[model samples]
Target: MDAINLVSARELARRNGLSFPNESPEYRQARDELLAEEIELRRHIERVAEQRRALPPGGQVRKDYRFQGPDGEVTLRDLFADKSTLVIYSYMYGPQRERPCPMCTSMLSAFDGEVPDICQQVAFAVVARSPIERLLAFKKERGWHHLPLYSDTTDEFSRDYHAIGPDGGDGAAYNVFTIKDGVIRHFWNPEMGFATADPGQDPRGAPDFMPLWTVLDTTPDGRPPSWYPSLTYGSGP
Candidate 1:
């Protein structure tokens, strides 16, 4: 069988049956152009993911990092359970902070519902520097039921994964690890930081993990420059 070539994004858009009745010609033209760009962006994201999956073997994990969970002490290897992949999201809730980072809380809020489905393919856990009791209390207060919360009681995991700065400030970090043939190794992380951010944009990891900013981006006002998530707000409407 002869291999068929894919059509250009613009051609694909032109051939699509989607239509909005009573829409102006200008709107159609603009929409079609945007559609093509969206197609290209989707392709680019796939390419980047492919590249990530093709990365060479990452650094070997030498330390047996321990975490405090509701069930008691669990090691780094134990987090993987039966899955080969493990995703750890380091929430910015350290012992010194009176409250957790609103940004991390917002992201975790979204993840709470996804944990069940996500865990089907890979093990997932949220780690923080706070005590296990405090972490669990906040988890309950925020109404998060599915997200597995753990405490990096000794701060080693946080420091090793760059979740805590040299000065001891907490930060949000996402890291993936792989366990193969009884060997645990680092996989990939979004190393982008404040210093590498583009002008007029906040420092964001590639493929922005949070859905909040992605949803806000569709608004006319877009994401506010000064506005950010808050730990608490006044009484509900």
Candidate 2:
């Protein structure tokens, strides 16, 4: 059988054997329609990924930016390691702030566990504008031993990559770079930010990268507008 286009989403949803207790006909009808839409949404995600993979080569990275990692100083090219693909997450942890951005920290915390598996296919690093010691200390405090943290001490990388705003504030950025024949080039980065957010929605890239947001999006509550992740949650009455 062909990998795709085997069956229509509506047909698949209708054939589902799942039935909940005390479900009315009205609910079932609406649920079946929703399931069909969900199936279509999954297919659309795959299509978007395929197109992204087929994109033409991005801008070449000519400058030799330096960063301070746990193992000492390293260049941007050094980040590729043995892998042709490199993924760097520019976290909001600049020296100006007493603490890192909670949202960025939350996202990185989730990535900590997935680092091992993800590194199998790509070299991944979490970069910040703070000093190496501060970055490492925070990593340890977060118990993120698997994540490879780095400090963009000079702000060269962050500035060039648009990870830092013009106001000298830090922001979250996920960038992918490709290396071939000793030449490094940018691959992809989501440009969506607060400016691109719809009237009632928070700015988020398609196929959201954060697991917390993804999970919350599936619930009936559907990611409350005011709800956000916090660095520490106290168990108070």
Candidate 3:
């Protein structure tokens, strides 16, 4: 919908009948104002997505990057399976680290449950610089069954995709590729990182992908400042 033709978000919010038990007039007024902003935010998100979808054709893939999956070595095109669109998430789980990045693991844990639904629309693959066997073992340990894990055995894909730093350290990456008329091409990937982060906030892409953060954002005390996800949390339900 065009912004100029639509009613103002404040007017729409003011017309809402939602009310909570024992909520004071002050609370309702403040909430209605916040609701107006939320409506505007939703419109902004839709606008951004529409612009992204309208982008011109991206760069074509030249190199035949290979990865090792449970079955055997597979080319980047093979990762697409039956879908024309593909999404690859390179988690920070290189061989140098004794354990996978807890943050990545946390994100994947949430993704695991949605893989089936996500794959219905586009192919999704989880990649790491670690060996296939190592990745499989960790996947089993985490009880993740749906994530299609692959190993960037040669680091060629990782290097080209900016998942590997100049110092050889691993970094998290999320890339989208599309195949049209049997030609694979790069689609989109978030460029925001440490260099683009705002003051007092961590570097993160727009439309945050992590459900953990999204959930915490709804609480009064949002995500903790110093706290981070761990491989294991000591004794909990």
lDDT scores in order? 0.92, 0.89, 0.94
**Which candidate, 1 or 3, would have the higher lDDT against the true structure?**
3
How much is 220 displaced in model 1, in angstroms? 1.9
What are the models' TM-scores?
A: 0.96, 0.94, 0.98
Error of 2 at 212 (Å): 1.2
- TM-score of candidate 1 relative to the true fold: 0.96
For model 2, the local distance difference test gives 0.89
Decoy 2 TM-score against native: 0.94
Per-residue CA lDDT of candidate 1, range 26-106, in tens?
Answer: 989999998998877887788788889999999999999999999999999999999999999999999999999999998
Query: How many angstroms is residue 219 displaced in model 2 relative to the true structure, after the best TM-score fit?
Result: 1.5
Clashing residue pairs in candidate 2 are: none
Query: Positional deviation of 115 in candidate 3, in angstroms?
Result: 0.4
Residue 211 miss distance in model 3 (angstroms): 0.7
- Candidate 1 lDDT score at position 213: 97
lDDT of 3 by residue, 56-102 (tens): 99999999999999999999999999999999999999999999999
Largest TM-score belongs to which candidate?
A: 3
**Candidate 1: C-alpha RMSD after superposition:** 2.1
> Distance from true position, residue 67, model 3, in Å?
0.6
